[model samples]
Each structure stands twice: as structure tokens, then as C-alpha cells.
Target: MSRLLFILALFLNTVYSCEVCEPCECNVIRFRRRFLCTADCSDRDLTSIPGTIPSEVHVIDLSYNDLHSEDLARLKLFTGYLTDLNLSYNNITYLPAQSLSTATQLNVLNLDGNILEKVDSTSFGHLKQLHKLIGIHAKTFEENSFENLEGLNYMSIVFGSQEVSENIFSHLKLKTLHTNFKTAKRIPEKLLNFGIDTLVDIYLDVPNVESLHENTFSGLTILKSVTIQTEMMQTLPSNLFHSGVNDDRKMPVNLVTVMIDGVKSLPRNLFDKQQSLKHLALNNIEDLILPKSESQVDTLDLSGSTLYRVSADWFTGFKNLRFLNMSRTKLVEVNNDTLMPLLSLTVLDLSYNNITNLPDHSIQSSQNTIVAFNVSHNQIRNISSLNI
Candidate 1:
């Protein structure tokens, strides 16, 4: 059959697209020549990069190894070719200048979960092509630690420095930044200023900032996504995302995701100026109150929460919302006006809940646009209210 022959040809093309390295169980993604070679050396007791790898290998995963300062010299041979390197989750302590002199072509580096207590200023100078770096340290990052990495556009630090100077990111072309200040109480003002006009995605895990300042992200004109997770954030201030004098003020960070593990109540005016918000997810929070917003967010997911009520005002401004996911919650009722404003809702997932009844006209607004209205795993014994 021609159809069977076509499938076979497609399978063979995929199988021969990459080769596996012998003795190391490494994968090689081939181009004109073999390019990306990811050798999963995790849990391997070997302390250094595999010396037997082909020189054309472009990426290497040396994570979870016992690599130390003495083994840093072994990476020099792959300097001209290797574009991405991972040295995270290792027992490495120090990153001296000599350790990086040979990584001439590295573009991305990860040093997360390491004890970098003595990295100096010149330690990153050799990585001229490096534009992204991920390191989580307690005290190694100095005020001007990133002055030499002018090409860096992205960075993720598990425990970033509070003492970082204001202008450390001024000379760089940074576009994305992720930091988890788990122990810190507040995000330093200098941190937001660092991403003035270039940052697109900013992720923070500062649990202690109970109330976010109104001017926290006022000037980040180009940001498209902002995610914040906090267990101790008790009070969320008003106008957290608002329009002001930025060049692109119509929308600031079109999507917002939060993981409030310990938050109990949602503030009413949290998203006053966030009219253009596209997607919002309040994931995995045991106790959460859906914030009453006048802004029309496109998609909203409130999975794994305990909501005892959903008044008509709860769905007032979400008229254009397309997807509503309320799975695995303690919702027992769907009142008539609870979802009346959702004129464009396409998918409604109420699965895995204690929902026992759907009152009259419960889904009347979504009867015209809904493609998937899932009410499985509930005590729903009637569908008389669902006119669709």
C-alpha cells in the first residue's frame, strides 16, 4: 500500500536523524555534521567531562557529577565547539579565572545548586559568547559580578544577591531573568530597574514579599510574561499590574501565573490595570479565593482549590474568557449567573470535583461557543439546565 510505504519512509528519516554515542549512551543530533551531543552524565561518579567525545559535539551535560576545581581544565578541549554546558547540582565550590579560560565558545551555562562562595570577577570573562547563565548561590555574586559578561541576555539564579548594584545589568542586553530569593523578604528595587525595556519574562520566588509595591514593574514595557510564587505573601497590594507612561502601556506582561501555596484570600483590586491579560493560572494552592477583576482575562485556571461560593460578580469582567478549568476543586454548585459573562468560553472543565448540581441556565452563555464542556467525575444527575 502507498500509505504504509509513506509511513515507513517517515519513520526511517527520523531514526537516522541522530546517532548514539558508544560507551557513554550519549545522543547526537545530526546536521551537515553531528551537532548537538547531549551526554547524560548525571549520577556518573566521573568527575570530569568525557574526553573521548567527538570534537564536533555542541552541547554537554556534566551535571550531578563530582566535578571539582581540578577537573575544570579538562573542558578546554571542547571550548571552540561546545555551545551549551551544564555543571549544576555538583559539589563544586570555587570558579576561579583559570577554570573558564578555555570555554571560549560557550553560549549558555548552568551552575545551579552549587556552593559558589569564591567566584571572582574575571571568572566569566573567557565565555565571550555566553548570553545566558543560571547559577544559584548564597554569597558569591558581588556588586559588579556580571560587568564582564556584556553579551548576557538571560540568567536564572536560585538565590540572587540583594547587594547587587543598580548598574550591573545596564551594559548587558538582558531579555529574561529568573531568581528565587527563598530566604529574602523583599525584591530589591534595583532588580526591576535592571530589566527596564529589554526583559520579556521575569520569574521570582520571593515568598516573603507579603505586599507587592505599586511601582514594582511600572517601566518594564517589553515584558510579556511575569510569574511569581510565594508561600508567605499574605497581602497583595492594589494596581500590581497597571497602565502608565510606558511606551507600550496597553498591556504589561500579557500573562501572569502564581503559585500561592499558603495564601488564603485573594485581594479584590489586584489586577485593576491588567486589562489585556491573556492567561492567568492560580495553580496548586490549597486555599485560594478567586480575585474579583474588572479586566477581561482570556483564560483562567483555578485547579486544586476550595471555593465555597462563586457569585455573579466573580465572572463580571471575564466576558471574553475562552477556557475555564476548575478541576480537582471543592466546587459543589454551578449557579446561573456564575458564568453568565463568558460569551467566548470554548472549554469548561469541571472534572474531579464534588459538584452535585447545575442550576437552571448554568451554561446558557457558553451554549453557542463551547466546544468541550466536561462535567465528568461529579454527582451531576441532570443536564436540563445546559441548553446546548
Candidate 2:
């Protein structure tokens, strides 16, 4: 009898048990004496939530399924245990109001490849604990679409329709945002008024934008980086980068990086207000205009521009400039006084230009601080007069 009992235990151990999440593969991950389980129901022809998913499941991958929008209502069964949900490439269209109201512990949600038309208010009101939201491509987001998502800090979305309202994101406290304006030509000033106190980085890919206003980024107090990539942008206002002013402080101090590509013209005093600005890149700009007043920019990249002759006054106000790159900018001559005011410059790149000569006093002022200088791929015929 003892030998028969041992044989039965061996048979049980050999057969895999999937009673926790039948029809889905369950993986148990052990971490610090804790067991976290994931249920992968992807690529299944599931029309609704599996009834066998255990309550302890933390992550669920329901991608490439035929689940309709109503099938998501069954998620309430695993309310507190569900942390991540990937509903990508599904047949979901409209999200019912309050469908996920009981999911208080949910953190991350992905809804890629869905043809969602509208997001009404209170749809995500109960998800106060959600952290990152990804792939929310909708035509319109109602006034309070993100009403109670107080913990949502990161988002990557595409505004598919051109009728997106200005206040669609006014309720979020995101720290990082990556948005693509599909058909919008210009971003309204108040479109990004959300996350004033917490936002750190923002990326805007506007393929059709033609111009930008001065107060496009006015309210944020702690924003650190701004990158705008466009193919049709032509004009920029002088105060485009004016930093947010604090009540107790007179000067702005948080903003540090600014990069804009594919622009035609830039107005004077463009960065005069950014006292803490450090790195600036204006690549592929057809017509470049240096700021008339002093700026604290440390790194400046003017590559792929249409500069024929670099003027001496361009670097006069850039006293704190360090790294300068003018590679691929059609330049004929870099006069002697052109870099005289860049006393703090450390690295200079003038490669791939039409320059014919590296004059003796061209970089004389930066001799003490300049460490790397490149003038390769130019029409330079004489370097005998240069000291180094």
C-alpha cells in the first residue's frame, strides 16, 4: 500500500496542473519569497474573459483576441490583484461607462489597435491608482475623460482626429508625455496646461505643423525637456520658450533642454527668458537667427542649415556656450572674429562645409578652453597660419 501511494504522487507530479487559468498559459514568477503569476491569453479566439482565471493573477495579456468591449466587464472579479492589462489588437470599440470602476489596484493599461471613437467622462474615474497609460488612440476625449486618474504619470498616445479639444488632458499629472498630432497644423496654447506641477519631459511630433505661438509651453514649473519635430514648421515667435515664473522667484530655473527641427525662421530673443536653458539644437533650419540677447545655453547644434556666411555677432551673446556644431551647414568662410566671444567653448565642429581656409585667429579666443576642433571635409587649402 505504501508503494502504491508513492506511485500515485509521482503520477500527479508528472501531469501539469492548469486549474488556475485553464485555456491560458500561467507563469509563476518568484521574487523575494513572493509569487507573482501572469496569465497569457493572447492569440486565443476568446470572446469573453476566461472564467477560470484565478483571483491571484497579476498580469493578463489578452492581445490578438476577439473579445468585445463588453468582455472587459468581467475584470472586476480580479479587482485588487490585476496590475497590468494588455488589450492590444482586440475587437474592442466602445468602453462602457464605469466598466472598470472596481479595479482600484490596476496600474498599467494598453489599448493599442482599437478603433475607439470617443472617451466619455467617468470612464476612468475609479482608476486613481493607475500609473502608466499607453496607446489610447481616440477621436475625442470628453471633458473629464481622465477625471480621477491622479496617479497616472506616463502616457504615449496619438491624437487621430483633427478635432481634439484643447482641454483633453487638463486633468492629468503626467511626468512624461509622447504625443503625435496626426493632422493638426498648430497646437493651441492651452492644450498642454495639464501637469503644471509634475511634468518633466514632453515630445511633440507634428508632421503638419506650420507655426508655433509664444505661449505654447507657459505654465509648467518643473518641465525639463522639450523636443518638437516637424516637417512643415516655418515660423517661430520670439518668446516661444518663455519659462514659467514662480511667485517667490523672479527667474525661471527648471527648463534645461530645447530642440526644434525643420524650421525656416527663428525670431530674435527666442531664448532670452530661459535662464536655466543648457542644450539647444536647431537642426535642418532653412534660415537661422541667433538670439540678440545673452542665453545660458551650453551646447548648440546648428547642423544641416543653410548658413552661407557665419557672422561674428552671432556668438557675441553666447558667452557661456561650450559645444558648437555646424556640420553640413553650407558655410563659405568662418571669419576671424566669428568665435571670439565664445570664451567658454570646449568643442567646435565645422566639418562638411565649403570653408576654404582656417585663418590664424579664427579660434584664438577659445584656445584656453577649446579641447576638440574639427574642420574636416571642407575646402581648406591652407592650415599653415593656424597655431594648432
Candidate 3:
């Protein structure tokens, strides 16, 4: 009886020795195990990942599957040195908090194109060495979703027809961020809430914003350049560049250039106290009204605006002005006083207008300071009448 029992036990062990590989194409292309196992379960009809994945596996590609929150919860057994994880193009709606928090050494996490709505604050706290995060398509984010990730460098949030709150990205230390919103009505104040006081680049491409409140960008002191595109903005508030005026009673002075397109007109005293402003570009404006102030501006661009005529003394306060662009307007003639206050002016662009002739004293006031003049596509027939 003892010999018969031993033979039955040996047969049972041999039957289950080699695990049956799932009938998928990814399992056919086998490779040597570096640590324990490396599986390619992508493009298979996998409803859920097998719970027995070896901990020694380093690379796992589980993309193009029907994974959900429940399936992701089974990843708590992963104890290997997983550095890269691809879960893109899945049917995941919410992230499994327990599984993700246990994967401490995960560096790259790709969760794009999911139906995620909110990200828990402590979801990424365990990944101390995480470098990049690619899951921004959610409609909104929890306040603390990026609470303890101090080592994170890059993040991208590509939402699908959703509106993100202004304070969504506050207190993060990321160097680069790309956000696309469908109907974002307001620019959240949290965008300027980085505690570092400086950012490399920020691109805001919201198309539904209509108005920008005063002190909209008051926190970013070390910002070098800013580009904003929206369909509803028509004017700029007076204290738009002044940062944190209510809290510490200080202003942002490091701003260098401001480019605004698709506005109808500019309010009076638009740049009242912006002392450090250097370059300004205003395009696609049909009519412009200058504010009354003695502010100093270095460069100005009014290209592609339908400006008919600028009132005399319009540029009287800009004594340190250098470059001016007035290309593509409807001006037929410029008065002598309109070109009198530009003492330090150098470059002037008057192309694509209806001017038949240059004023007699237009170039007389700009003798040596003016170097380049673009007057193409105009009605000026003679070039000798003007003293450029």
C-alpha cells in the first residue's frame, strides 16, 4: 500500500510541474528569464491578469486588455524590480490604490485613455523614485493626488471634454505639464501655487474662458514667458501681472514678455504699474484704446489688428520704446504727432495698410534711431518723398 501511494504522489507532481501557458500569441515568443519571469500579455483577450506572476519579472506589457479596478487590485503580489509598466488603452475607470501603493520602485506608469474621474491624493506617495506620470485624462483630481511625490519631474493630463479646476496642480514640483481642456471657464489660481517661485514653461490652451480676473497670475515670480489662447477673452484687467498683492502686498517683477491674441481692445491703464515689462504683442485686435499712464515699454506689436487710426499722444509715455509693429491695418495716413514721442525707437512695421504716402516728417523724427521700416503692400508710389 505504501509503494502504491508514493507512485500516485509522483504522478500528481509531474502533471502540474510545467504551468500551462495561456493560448495567446504573446506567450509563444518566450525569452530567458533575467530575474524570474518576463511576460508579454498584450493584445490578448485577457479579462484579468493572472495572480501568479513571478516577482522576479522586470518588464510587463499588459496594454490592450480589459482591465478594471478589480484586476488592478491583484497586483499586490508583485515584489520584483518592475521599472516600466504600460496599461494604456484599457477599460480602467479608477485606479486600485492598494496595488499601486505597494509597487514602490515603479518609475514609469502609463494610464492614458481611461475613464478616470478623480485621482486619490496618496495614490503616488509610495512611489518615491517615480519620474514620469501619464494619466491626465480625468475630469477632476483630488486635492492631494500628488501629495508626497517630491521626486516627480514630468506630468501630463489630457482630459476628454472636461473642465479642470484651477487649484488642480497646486504645490507640485513638476518641470513640464501639458493640459488640454474642452470647456474650462476659469484659469485656476493653483497654477501659480508652486512653492518654488519659478517654473520653466507653462502652456494653457483652454478655448472656453471668457474673462481673466485681476491678479490672475500673481504667484509665479520666476516665470520667463507665457502663452494663453482662448476664444472668449476680450480685455485684460489692470493688475493682471501683479502677484500675491493681497497676501504679502508685493508684485511680480520678473516678467519679460506678454503675447495676447484674439482680443477686441485694450483697456486704459492696462499696464499701469508693470515696471519690468519688456515685450508686448497684441494681434487680431480690431480696435485698440490705450490707457493713460506714463509707463515704460521696450517693445510693442500690434500686428493683424484692424486699427484705423491711433489718437495723437497715444505713444507719448513710452520714452524707452524700441520696436513697434503696426502691420496689416486700415490706416491711410499717420499724423506727425503720432510719430513724435518715439525718441528711442529703432524698428517700425507699417506693412499691409492703406497708406498712399508717408507723412513728410514721419521719418524726420526717427533719423538715426530707426533702422528697419516695413511699408510693403501700401499705396505709396514714390520713395524719394520720405526722408528715412
Candidate 4:
């Protein structure tokens, strides 16, 4: 009798136990202590959700399936345990209304790589606890599309259409908005007309944007970090980056950072009128045209350019200038007293340049007020002012 019991246990362990998710080409991942079991049905050529998902599964991956209403309907059965739903790359053009209404606990939703040119407004309202929304190929946004997403904080969308609107960003609590566009000529003038002050990090990664208008970013109230990476932009119109004031704070405020990448040239007076602008980083330019700004920028980076020389008079405008970076710029020579005017400079990085020798008193005027100076990766032979 004992031998028979042992044989039965072995049979159960070998073939009788339910260890795999069935009815579809899938993989079931189980964790003993930390991870909840997950059903991965990605890239399975499945037109519908598997009929039999493991009962212990708390996460499902249907990202690459040709899912339809039937697949989504299966989710209502496991709504209690499932928190994440990945429907990316499903070739889905429309979302059936209330298909996930029972999934009130859905927290993360990824709709990337779908034909999301059309969608029902209330398709997302059922996900009250949803925080992160990753979308792709967006055509337009209706007002009620994101109405119930109160806890939403992180959102990144890839634009497939130029139909921008004011209500698109309204009534959300997003801290960061990363909008990457393909061949978008311009960001609609009133994209943020609702005055969403909670947004702090706004990244516009539209490579083909030709020009920036003076009122491009006019409605933002409290934007702290701004990054605009474009392709072959010759010049930006004046007042292109002047942002609106935040009424919540009585004191003056400037954006903590501003980064410009992949621009070929800078129009004169590019940074001229801004009051609170501080850190400025210019990258990946074939030519260098320093903008004339009377306002103070404590940190300035002119790296990865084709410039060969720098003049002292070009920096006389910055009053509170401190940090300067000219790395990887191929600057071989500096005019006499080229860096003498920066009285408050502490950190100067001239590494990765073709500089052979320092011109007389080159940056020597700043040694007393400077803290750390890096001139490594240069072809330096004469150290005129820097003794060591």
C-alpha cells in the first residue's frame, strides 16, 4: 500500500499536475516567493485569449496576439486577480466599450503598436487605478478619453496624426509627458490650453519640426524641465521658448533646464529675453552661433560641435555664469583672455578638443575663482597659465 501511494505521487508530479497555460501557444512563468505567476501569450498567432488561463496567474501578456472582443471578454473572468494588461501590436483599430468594465483594479495599460486611430471614449474610464498609459500611433484625443484616470502620472505617446487639441492634456495628474512625433511640422499652438500646472517634465522629441513659433509653449504655468530635440532646424523664431507664468507662486521663476539637440544653427538673440533661464545645453551642431542673452545662465554646455575658436566677448553678456563645457567641439585655439570675463566660473571643461596650447592668460583669469578645471583629451604642449 505504501509503494502504491509513492507511485501515485510520482504520476501526479510527472503528468497529472496543471503546470502549463493551455488552449494557445503560450508560456507560464511561476515564482515561489516574489513574483506572481504570469501567462505569456505574446507572438502566439492567437486571434483570441486562451480559454483556460492558469488560476494562479495575476499578470497576462497578450501583446502580440490578434485579439478581438472575445479575447477581451475573457479578461472579465479573471478581473479580480489581473492588474496589468498588455495589448500592444494586436492590430486592433477599435476598443469595444465596457469590454474591461469589470477590471476596476487594472493599474497598467499598454496600447502601443495598435491601430489606435479610433477608440471609444469610455474604453479607459473603467480603469480607475490606472497610472501608467503607454500609447502609440495616436490620431486624436477626445475629452472623456482619459476622464477616469485620476491616478495617472506617467504617459508617453507616439503621434501618428497632426490633429492636436487643447483638451488633450486636460484633467490629468501627469508629472511627465513624453510626446514623440513622426514628421510633425509643429506642436499645435493650444495643445496645453487647459493650464495643467502639475506637469514638470515635458519632452518633445519631434525630429522633423521645422520651426518653433514664439507662442509654442505659451500655456505652461510651471514647467521645470524642457527638452526639444529636432532635426536640421536652422533657426527658431524669437521668444520661441518663453513660457507662461505660474500664478501659484508669487516670486519669480525660471525653468531649471533647457536642452537643444540636433539643431544646425541658432538664430541671433536665441536666448535674449528670457529672465529666469539657467542651465543651457546645446548639442550635435555642425556650426556654433552663440545666442546673445542678457539674462544669467549659470551652466552652459556647447559640446559636440564643429567650432574651432571661442572669443571672450561672446560671454560678456552672462552675469551669473559659472559652469562651461566645450568638450568634443574640435576647438583648437582660444583668443587671448578668451575666458577672462567669467569672474564667477568654478567648473570649466575643455576636454576632447584639438587645443594644442593655451593662448596667453587663457582661463588664467578664472583660476582664482575656479574650483575644478578639466582640459584632458587635448593635444596640449604649452601650458601657459595652468602650471601643473
Candidate 5:
């Protein structure tokens, strides 16, 4: 009898100590877990993540929670297999270094809308495997905060009112850095240090920058496109598009697009040595000027700018150009030589301008390649001289 009681007690203990499996409905599930252990819970209204989170769970969504810094620390149990974590739109202010130091397998982390003020270097020291990080709408980072994330590949900084520290991204291997009109002053000089020799695109939305410092974009050798919001700009620096000292040193040999809107004037040599620029948009500009004989731009758009006139030799060196737009500029006259050197010109937009007359030789030189012409909304009394 004594032996029988001992065996029964041992069996009971073993049964109670084993991890229990929980039931989940297939209809309401978003992610599928392999173990289905008691370790994983979603939308449980548990204000805090328990430190005993099952070590086997790989993906965790603590989103839409009121989790603060202290509550986030409770997730220390997930230091092993937690690869993907989303803590967006939470009440967290600061990320604890201890909580992140052990997360070895973490690859993708999203902390988009938290009240974070600064990211300490140690917060990302252990996340060597991290690939994608999104901190779009948070406040700015402290200096050298991103010094430890050298292995990161993809990053996004969308729609925020923060000024990123200069060289804030010097250490990472970023593919995209999307920024809106956040900073009121000039772009931080450190922004040019990000080995742009490998960058594909840089989308800038600084509508308030009136003047860009010369040599502001000196190192973007491999850059493809640059989109700038120019609604509040008055003038563009002469070397706006000259990234390097010489043409051969530029990294982005196949530069594609340059989009700008709402500027007053473009200085001469705006595109000095950029041989690869293809599509250009100068929308909403009030005053516009083309480069001298030494310039080279492929496609140009001057639509929505209040332009008044185009003098002779204004577009002298745009020999490889294809498209040109001068709509809504209030232009009354264009010299005969304005469209002479543009032998490759295809499209011209002269809409919404105060153009009541065209020069007698307006089409004298542009008879062969000119494909489409827009003269709508002009005060033209006759179309006899105009021919496309």
C-alpha cells in the first residue's frame, strides 16, 4: 500500500507540472502559433506583460496597449525567440536597455508612435540581427543614439516634427529614409555623411528651407532620385544638384528624377555636372530660370510657376532634353532662340500664362521634333504663328 501511494503521488505531481495547452478559435486568429502553449496571449487587457512569457513564442503583438516602460520590462522572459515585436501606439516613453539587451533573435521592431525622447546606444547593442526598424512619428533622437545599429538594412522615418541629429544614421546600412517638412532650418550637415554611395533614394520634404548651403549634397554618389518640397523656398543655391567636386566622382551615375515645387528662382548652373537627370518637376514656382551653356538636364517641368518671359539662350545647353512645361507663368513672349537648342524637345506646356502673342519665329526652329504644345488659358488672339 505504501508503494502504491508513492507512485500515485509522483504521477499527480508530474501531471500538474506539465504545461497546459490552450484552445484558440480559428475564426478570430491573425497569426498562427506552433505550440499553442499558455505562454501566448493577445488583447487580454493585461496592462503588463508577464515576465514568464513562454520562451518558445517567436512573434508577439503588444500593440494597442497602455504598456509603459515598467510594463515593457516585464517582457524580459522573451529574450530568446522573440524575433518580431510591435509596440506601436503605446504609452511607453523610454525603452529599457535591459529589456532589449537579451533579445538576440529580434529582427523587425516597430515603435512608431511612442513618446520616446531619446534612444540610448545600449538599447540596440544586442540587436545585431535587426533588419527593419520603424520609428516614424516619435520625437528626435539623442546624439550618437544610433551608433550601435550598424547591421540594420531597412529604416523609415515618416511624418514627424523632430530634427534628427547630424550623422544620426551614420552607422546603419539604411535603404530608405523618408522625411517630411520637419526641420525649419537647413538640413543637418551630417545628413550628407550617410554613405550615399549605396543609397537608392532620398525623399526630402522641407518646404521652409529658403536656401541650401553650397556643397550641401556632396557625397551622394549612388543616389537615384531627390524629391524636395519647395513651396516656401525663394531661391535655390547655384550648386543645388552638384553632389561631388567633379563629374567622374559622382556615385549615382544614372540619376533619374529631381522634383521641386513653389520656388521663385533657380540660379545658373543649378545642374552643373549631373549628366543622368531625367525627369524634373518645377511645379508652383513663381520665377524660373534655366542654366547656361555648360548645363545638361534631360526632362524639365515649369508648370504652375508664374513665369513672365523666356529670353534668348535661356535654355542653351539642354540639348538632350525631351519635355518642357511652362504653364501658368503669365508669359507674354518667348524669344525665337528660346526653343532652338532643344532639338530633342517633344512636349511644351504654356498654359494659364498671360501670353497674348507668340513671336513670328516661335515655331521656326522647333518644327521637326516638337510633339505636343499646350497654349490653353492664354490671351492669344490668333494661332497663325504657332505650329507644333
Candidate 6:
């Protein structure tokens, strides 16, 4: 009887293995008490979508293959069930009008490494539920290319060394935009105005950008985070964060994080309007200018800067600051009252400087709250047991 039971079990296992998604791996997932499958068909050198992949597969990864636009017709089999699809690093150039007409439930799509040059209204018109889009390296986008993506909250795209079309992001309500473009001297004010009501975070990775104007971020009412990285920037406008009175929104501005690297000079009142900013990073500034305005910033980073001395007034408004990183800022000394205003500072990194001594009362005010103090790679040669 035991031998018969073993034979039956073996036969059942063989039958189940034969019905599995082949040339790809499927992992059964129990979501909401339903047994769903996620298929990974990456790096299979597949020219076409495998017919063996079950229609109930919720997530499909067909990256690193030779798939083309014609192969996407197989997505019709999954229809309204597929949630996530990754076809990155493929040779797909053009998306047919009806290619994704049935993918109404697709939430995330990644098409990173394809050389698609044009994106029109029909390419992604049916993806109403798409929340995140990764890697759209398109050159020419029609006016209404993204009008149907009402639910798209995050997008990562390359603008391909051309001027950004203002109408490309017309009706979409994006919350975060991570974009890259070369050859443009500055970001077009009109392009960002499209999502001004909903855009919260904007990361500009333009390497060749030369300058930014005061009205660069004019009307973004609910904007919170802004990180700009450009090597060619010389100076930042003092009112770069100032939202003019022309914007009629009543809600309080909520700008929180600002990181601008590789600039020459920062105006003294550069952050006078960003009172709600918490994390500020101005690394690699040639001539660092400390803002005189009292801010609510908690985490400050001046790494790779060239500040020679720190004054007591610099920390007057930094009472709530906890983490301070001045690493690589060419400082020669810290005055006795330099850090007296930082009542809540807990972590201080003053590494990679030319400081020779720590005065007895240099950090005396922060002795109680200070936890980790790093001064390595400095020219320190004095004995300050109280600060050790």
C-alpha cells in the first residue's frame, strides 16, 4: 500500500511540473486568498512571448531579450489582470495603437534601454492605472502623448539633448519627476507649470545647465523637495525658492529638502523664503555663503565646500538641527561660540579640514545632546578631553 501511494504522488508531481510556465520561472503568490503567479522571463533570448506563460500571471519580466513591438500583442492574453510588466533592454522601437489597449490594470511598466524615438497619443493610452513609468528615452513626443495617464504619479525619462515639449506633461498629475536632459541651458518654466498643482518632488540631473532664474520654481504650491545637479552653474538666484504672490494658493508652502551641488557662489538670503526646509545640502560650492535667515533646517551638509571659518551667528537659527556635516570644508578653526546656538545638535562631522585645535568651549553647549562627533583627517594636534 505504501509503494502504491508513492507511485501516485510521483505521477501527480510530474503532471504539475508539466503545466508550469516553461522557459520562465513562476512563483505562486497568495494575495487576498487567491493563488496568483509571477512570471520572470528575463534573459531568455526570447523573440516572442512564450505561449506557455499562463494568462493569470500577475507580474511579468521580459527584460534583456530580443522582443519587439509585435511581441506585445501577446499581452492581450493577460488583459485586465497583469499589474506589473518589465520589457527593459529590448529592441522595441514602436508601440502599436492597440498593443496595450486591454492592459487596463497595469500599474508599473519599465522600458528603460529601448531606443524608442517617438511617443504619441496611442502608445500608452489604455494604461489608466499606471502609477510609475521607468525609462522612456524618447526624442520626439507628440502634444498629447501622456494625456491618458491620469494615475501616473512617478516618471523617469530622458529628454535626449533636446528642448522639452511643454505639452508633453499637460494633463498628468505627477508627484515625483526624475528627469535628465543635456544641451538645455535651463529648465523651461512652462514645462514644470503643467504639474505645478500636484508636483511635490523634482530632481533635475542636467549636467550642462548653466544657470537658473529666480522664477524657476515659481508656482509649485505644494512643492517639497528639489535637488539640482549641474556642473556648469555659477550662481543661484537669491529668490530661487520664493513662490511669488501671483500664485493664489492659500495652503502654506511645504518646501523641505534642497540639494544643489557644484555652484560657485550662493546668495546670503538664498533660503530666506524656504522657512520649512529641513534638510539642506550645498556641496562643492566654490564660495559658500551662509544664509542669514532663521530657518527650520535640521540636517545641514556643506561637504566639499570652501568655508574658512564658522561664526556663531551661523548656528543661531539652527537650534533644531541634529545632524551637521561640514566634511571637506576647508576650515582652520572652530571658535569657542561657533556651535553655541545649536542646542539640539547630536551628530557633527567635521572631518577632512585643517583645524589644529578644539577650544574648551567650542562644542560645550552641545555636550549633553552630542552623541557622535567625527573629526578624522583633520589637522588636529591639541588635547581637548572635554570634546573627545
Candidate 2: tens digits of C-alpha lDDT, residues 1-388: 9999997775443222323576888877666785566889999888998987766677889999998888888887775767888998898877876677767788999988886787776567678899998888777767778777889999888887776678878888899988889888778777777767777888888889887765677666688998888899777765566533443322224579888888777766667666788898988988888776778889999999889898878887789999999999999998888998998989999999999987889988888899999999999988856554
Worst 10 residues of 4 by lDDT: 243-252
TM-score of predicted structure 3: 0.61
**lDDT comparing candidate 6 with the true structure:** 0.82
Model 6, C-alpha of 286: deviation from truth (Å): 1.6
- Candidate models: Cα lDDT each: 0.70, 0.80, 0.67, 0.71, 0.67, 0.82
Q: Write the per-residue lDDT of candidate 6 for residues 215-268, one digit (tens) a residue.
A: 667678788999988889888776677644564423225789989888888887
| Candidate maximizing TM-score | 6
Local accuracy of candidate 3 as per-residue lDDT tens digits, 1-388: 9999998885444333223335322222233632223456677877898654544344567888888878887677776456667788898877766777657778777887776766767556677777777765666577677776767777767654445555556657776565556667776654556734546445556667777766556666666555555667777675666533455634455556667677666776565566666887777776676535655668988888777777777887777788999988787777777878888889999999988767677766777799998899989875555566
Candidates ranked, most accurate by TM-score first? 6, 1, 2, 4, 5, 3
Q: For residues 249-276, could you state the per-residue lDDT of candidate 4 as single tens digits?
A: 2211357787888888776656644577
Q: What is the lDDT of residue 140 in candidate 4?
A: 56
List model 5 lDDT by residue over 65-84, tens digit each. Answer: 66788787666766465777
Query: Which lDDT value does model 4 have at 270?
Result: 60
Query: How much lDDT does candidate 3 score?
Result: 0.67
Q: Which ten residues in a row have the lowest lDDT in candidate 6?
A: 243-252
lDDT value, candidate 2, whole model? 0.80
Segments of candidate 1 deviating more than 4 angstroms: 1-22, 25-28, 31-43, 160-171, 243-264, 283-296, 376-385
CA lDDT for candidate 1: 0.70
Candidates 1 and 5 compared: the better one by lDDT is 1
lDDT: the better of candidates 2 and 6: 6
By lDDT: ranked, best first: 6, 2, 4, 1, 3, 5
Deviation in Å, model 4, residue 220 alpha carbon? 2.0
Highest-lDDT candidate = 6
